[model samples]
Target: MTDPRWGEAFSTAFAQLTALWPDKVAIGAAVSGLCALMETDVALAYICFGALTADMTARVAVCCKRNRPLCRGLKRALPRYVCYLVFIVMAWAAQVAFQRGLHVGLPIVDIMLAYLILTDMASIIGHLHYLGVPVPPVLKWLVFGGREQLKRKAREAAGRERR
Candidate 1:
């Protein structure tokens, strides 16, 4: 018979790993860009990038619980992710509006995807900030203004909890 404690440990490890999967996929998207072969299909590459970035943004939202909108029980983080989804939809719609309505020369796919890359970077850095991880100078400015914003948010949350 399998040891119950061992089974519990395995279950816990699996849960943690599953929770981390989105972050790993985001890192994979970054590493994929380094591969010359993937560049051959530029359109597909951009689509993949767009999809990954949208997912990463939502996943990052799911990761940061303290600052998230209030929801209850098993699906508390879900509403927060929905907010990120709205941002993704709006971004795509803006790209369409800019290209079709205004008759700009911009490629909608490329522009929207490139914008999503920036958004993903911001979310990734934000996640790092929430985790108390050290981030580089560029990402610092891009995400939280050198952790001061994070510190302020933390202080605000503490004050609220004290009340």
Candidate 2:
């Protein structure tokens, strides 16, 4: 049996990892850029970036407590990632309004938004399996299998607890 301390260590490590992942940083960058574009102020934009990061970090903590390893997985994070899309749309609208010109020029924002959304969704699908959340068969084949691993560990942990 794993030591209780191991679980704590794992939790701490995973929490730190989730906070520092590339996807989260990209989301923060989106918020930062949006604030910068809207206010014409770099500092204010960075402040907004920091706020979003902090908020996400808190949410991760909540998710960890509520769902454990499954929360740390991608499925839960994927749904939550929808917020990033909302941020992008809001930013685009603000930019269009501020410029007062119908400039739909392609920007780095589009690429970032697309990559972030796709990657986050992929992770979420994997995590959903860990939680035994039924994903469509089409998606199940696409995601890395996590259901059995999570289920085995969950059952083992429960057995230990009952002993």
* Predicted structure with the largest TM-score when compared to the true one: 1
Error of 2 at 67 (Å): 5.0
Mark the regions of model 2 whose C-alpha exceeds 4 Å error after superposition. Answer: 1-39, 70-82, 85-89, 92-95, 98-163
| Candidate 2 structure, TM-score to reference | 0.29
Question: Highest lDDT among the candidates is held by which one?
Answer: 1
lDDT tens digits, residues 61-152, model 2?
A: 55675665644634544554467657666656655653465443333334334334344445555545554668898765543334344345
Query: TM-score of every model?
Result: 0.34, 0.29
Clashes of each: 0, 3
Clashes of 2: 3
Which residue segments of model 1 deviate by more than 4 Å?
Answer: 1-104, 142-163
Per-residue error at 65 for model 1, in Å?
Answer: 7.7
